[model samples]
Target: MSQATCPQCHAPFTPGQRFCPNCGKQISSTGEGVIPTVAASNSSLPPTMAANSNEGLPPTMAAGSNPNLPPVGNSNPNLPPTMAAEDPANHQQPYSQYASGAYTPPPPPSYNGYPGGTPTPNDPYAPPPPPGPGMYSMPPIPPKKKNSLPWIIGAVVVVLVLAVCGGSLYGITQLFSKKSTDNKTQTTTDNNNNGDNSNDTATKSVTLTNLAISYATDQITFTSIEQADQFPDDTYTKTYSYEKKSNFVRIHMKEKQEGGRSAYFSYSSAFSLILPDKTTIKALNAGEFSGPKEGEQRENWVDFETKKPVDLNSLVLRLGTAEEAQMEFPLKSNADLSEYLPKQADLNKAFNYGPMKWTLNTAIQRYDAPGAQAKKGKVFVIVSLTASNPSSSDFWGYDYIRLKSGDTTAAPEYTSDDDDLNDLSAGASNVKGTLIFQVPPSDTYTLVFASGKNLSGTNVTFSIK
Candidate 1:
């Protein structure tokens, strides 16, 4: 709104005027150039500002404003005046675009460091330049994820090893301890019995017979002697029943028999038993069985005069009807009597020792229908040993018993005879005196036992556990 004098040409012009009309020089705030200076006045000027102040000049003369003008006193006044150069408004300042460029941007105002172009000189809330990228570098990468699997595996392995070792040690300790304890118990038992003459209740005697009847052992008793001198070779009798249905024998003791107390008794005796088929079985050695001889019958006679190993394969004891049972136990009496007499060899074959003790072992063999070929669920009668003889006497003597109906010859595996009544045997006996049999599932059985001339009857009973 005002004009000032140009220092070079003494000419006045407005503030935006870049060159003086009379001379050539740049205008400055100091008014030291030929450019026109603005003058303050009350004069009303148009509010529109033209980008080129040269709009006031003719286009031809506008180009001539760039001037390193000669002095205003030059004689040639016909030439258009050259003015001083001025800054162009539309030109871009390259350095101003980037903060790092050569040009420095004006500092933000003092308050909060926000751009106000110029600072409030006394503002108290101004801040420094905002934090730079340098302050925000990423924190270093976190440590790799910690893996605990290896530690867990190691701990488990250690625990397993410890457990295995502990188990092995414990097993070894127990093994040794058990062996020592067994030896100690045996020693103590022997020491206590050193001079004792009383018979051991555990050591009992049992008589054996061949009866084809299924019978269950309810109670059994055996009598044992401390020495052979106490063994009695006396004649005795017992009753038993041969089951008609199961073809098994059930044995019972005679009330008059001294050893007949309940179903158990004690005795020490050995004898050779022979069947009707001439199957000579040694009932002496406690562990020997005799195989069926030629033409052997099922359950006929138990000769106490023959001692031979009995092979179970040679024997036949089958479940059959009462009518069929007779086929197995045919009644055959020797009219000549001398024809069936036992020989000296038979007497020698009698039980090797006497006054021996034995324990009975009874168990269920089979329980099925009645018939030589019956299905399951049918029952068989169980037969028990009623009496037996231990004397090695007359050669002509033989044992006789009645298996009136159901009867089965004892397998060699289930026969035994002990040598010393009060002492242990040399080996374990597979020959068990006690027998187990299954009768009709819901029925009972009966049998009988007797003595031969070569052996005296010693009544005794047996039972199941």
Candidate 2:
């Protein structure tokens, strides 16, 4: 048979159903009703459907609303008593059974009313029963699992960064430390070598304090020493300025010396040092000293230096000219400088030269030269010379004659014809000429003939003091 639909809700249901399960509306078997009658879900059962009640209608006829079906009351002997359990009351009472604490599972649905199907034993599609009243409590919701992966990775990165930085810093520190240690070691070694060198110089050097030595015409007493920086010292002083540091000592007694051969001793080459190798160096920075007068003491400081280091202990004082230094008592330093001066011919004598024989007849000082006047602190010296050329080559007398002192030299005055000694003819035999020289008034001088026409190095010396 085709399934019938509920009238009020128009929902498809079984023909034997007395109410719609979806909308719970009562069904009429005779015809579809336009009016809807909804049963209250929690209301008490009607009197006609109550158990053991003598009502107007029987169970099967009222429960199913099927007019063609016979009534099956409790009085029917041919039907089972549970046959009336299909009533709507019995159909909706399963939930109430749970509420009353007596729930029981319902039987599987019958499929005999379905098309082409017999009743199956187990209906897999049946609705499950509610659990017993006290049997259910929802399983506790598990706490949410937390994730720590990002935190772990960040911590690892931080640790790696710190490790790299620490390693780099340690390496840099070690490098600097090693370099500093090496520098310190080198400095210490150099200092030790310097100390050894100082010891050696000390062994060779002699003490200078209060050491007195005798000379030819004077005596030298050394009182103190300040080593050199070796430039010329224009002013004389007992002490000096230096560049480096040393063990400096002071002198209570001033350094004293006496030399009278050259009255201007401090400005001349009077005091000198004789080295062990027989080499000599003159002192430049000495105290102001002068005088050939008797019993006169002069202050002096001997400053001497060399291009190379030497033994100071073997050094000797040479108080006069270097050619006349004395080592023992009668040493060469005892000779008068004038006696040891270079050999010179007498003014009245005739000397033979390279290509000529010349006689220096006489000399006289005047206030005026041939063509030029004498300077304020100067005088004019006029001398007559007789010359003869014994050689074939011509010679010039003016080119060969000159006056010389330590560093002062004067040429023949060339302002007039009388002063021109160049007029002496070549190869002449007896030529006489007058030459004039402007020189300082009060100094010792030498007359020199340095060269001739046919030769060189004539270099004859004559005293003109």
Candidate 3:
């Protein structure tokens, strides 16, 4: 008379009953006749109760149970055709057949040729169907993303930026370089122009056309200029003597006043002579000359001496400290003397002055003289000259004459023992005299005559050999 519990609903029932009356699930019994306690509902059952219940249950019941199993006669048509034809109601015969002890449970259905043990009506342990071609699988993992495009874009942007910066830098450098080059070129051009201007300033030329002479505070007029190779007898050396003799270049000039006032000129410190070599020669002796009256012009002479002969074609005469010259003259030299002394026969001819005619008669060598003694290494030479004045004015014979042999020159000697051609008054017929010079005994000599004291007049030369 013990009770058994229905496994699906946990309802109590008599042990001899084949099924539970409340839920209509089948029940089983063993030969032991042991009663089975009613279990709590499976939803509320403790883990110990569930495990203990498995111990006493049959192997078919212990495997599993299914709550969604079809009823005994209601098999699913969606199952396999073979499984759908097997009726579960056929296995549930009346319980009176099981009471005879000869009834046995049906074998479990075979799944793919594997024998499943005897199955309970609603077994939960049915093996799942084998996987077919329609089974779901995880989506293919997405390919790893690539970053090549972004890197390329970034590199391109960087290159463009660098190009722009480099262009800007190049432009700036080129601008500065061009500016510096222009500045240097301008500086060089300015320096060259300055150099050219300086050269032009240093080298300047002026012509000598109608130049006026100046002395101190007075303005003078330059009339004429001449040159001679010797000094006059009474002017420089009174006796025939040996000294450093030089040639003379003379200037004939005059000064004028607005009114009748007289002007004085110092010949020595007043003027200077610039030779062709640009050397300046100052006057050795200082003397004064008087100016002319208001309308009448008086003549004055200034003399400059040089040890060597110069370019007689061009000479520069400067007065005081002036950078510009007072006068320039085209003087004459021995090369230009052929116009006056045409031939050697003309040396003794009467050459006409403005109001006088003069001639060189003869030259004689004298070894000794009465009272005039020649210096140790020297001898004397006598020259005869004649002068005639036909005009009303007096012919003054105070002129420079000399005898030249090579670079040596001797002035005339004034001696009381010889006939001297002094000043001839107006209406004088003719006068003759002999002039003497002490010189070294050479094979050749030249007698040079100066018409004026400054040695600047009609000059004549006679070769004496």
Candidate 4:
């Protein structure tokens, strides 16, 4: 808020001041000498500051009018004292700034060995200026976020691959080891068998119809394991329905007929799974089921558990029992049994035997229901027959007719539901029925009819297939 000083005398002056009081010089900061005007009326000032010098003035006759106010121009009483001289021929400092007068600017000063491009400093103690701004550029882009699902999936795939390779290697090792052990066991059994026949009991043949060796193995199935530290049951069932344990494993076996008889799986039976490390895991399910009959099957399940999953590679299922079991199908393999399954064969043929006209319909075998299924290595053959009794007397067909296959002969199965043709009354026409017989699968078969007492006098043979 301080005032500016005069450049001539260094005396302070206000903003609107037109002259320096101590030097008697006009100011040009008010733009006095910039505009053009008639020299007779122009009021102006000098460009450079001067204190006592009059070098810019020209020789004039009116000098001593008033020395204190610096000589007035031309002594023109009607004109202003600040106005320049009117004579165009005499163009000095103040008159040179007239409307028609010509003037020239002084040469610029030099600094730091270069031409003046920066402003001259008035305050010698001021600080230096700061450096200029830098060049323009664009902002940086942000990075994208990543998903974790693909990484998790890749990790899982790698784990599964490692597990499969390890399992396959373990299985191969166990297979070789099992073969070696079985060879040693067979050698020991042979040596023992040659010495005595009464030593072996549970694995000995009982009769011609029942043997001790393994036979028809049922579907052996297992379920995914469930692991827990606790269970909800005090006693475990064969199916592990209400029981649970750590590293639990359950296997289901159905219709396991051994040596033409059931395995006789009971609550007292001992079931186990042997591991590759010779560790045996005993079955936890000791629950009992009803015993199976002849030509039937025994269905059961075995459950085992341990504290940790160890030595579980290449397992072998085994069962042990008293002498009454007669059989046990352990360590079995999957085989194609499609040829043993019963199926129907269609046949339409007309023939005559004795007093009745007969039309043989079909011969089919089925195993869809219980007790109706054939035993292992055997099949059921039921032949449909349509008969017309034209005579007046009743005829019994069971006694006079017989079916034979290979070296085996079969009579009518009277206990079955297919015995309607065993007896035909008089005038009964187009009576259709079947004769059921259990037999083995064979291509050669014959049906025989006779017409004498006890069917022994005269007989007629009809080829079946």
Alpha carbon lDDT of each predicted model: 0.30, 0.47, 0.51, 0.47
Quote the positional error of residue 206 for candidate 3 in Å: 79
Worst 10 residues of 2 by lDDT: 245-254
* Model 1 Cα lDDT, one tens digit per residue, 56-108: 54332343342432222323232222312222232123212222354232233
Question: Which lDDT tens digits does candidate 3 get at residues 152-270?
Answer: 99999999999999999999999999799667645643543344422321111111225453332244555545444544622642121146655666666665443223444445654
| Candidate 2 structure quality by residue, lDDT tens digits, 1-465 | 345554544456654455554444555533343122222222366754443333565334344444533433334232223343333343345324444655323333433233322233354555443343555646889999899999999999999999999999999999999799667645643543344433333322223333444332235454433332232352222233344322211111133223223233342365566656887666554335442233456665445654454544345555544332223211121223332222222466477666567777666554333322345555566667777776666555446677664566787766423433465555676676766676765345556767644555433334445
What would you estimate as the lDDT of candidate 2? 0.47
The RMSD (Cα, Å) of candidate 3 is 29.8
The predictions' CA RMSDs to the true structure, in order, are 24.5, 22.4, 29.8, 17.0
Best by TM-score: 4
TM-score of every candidate relative to the true structure: 0.23, 0.23, 0.23, 0.33
How many clashes in each structure?
64, 5, 0, 0
Compute the lDDT of residue 82 as modeled in candidate 4. Answer: 39
Q: Which residue pairs come into collision in candidate 4? A: none
Candidate 3 has what TM-score? 0.23
Cα lDDT tens digits, model 4, 177-228, are: 9799667646644543353332332121111111122222222233222222
Q: Is 3 or 4 the stronger prediction by TM-score?
A: 4
Candidate topping lDDT: 3
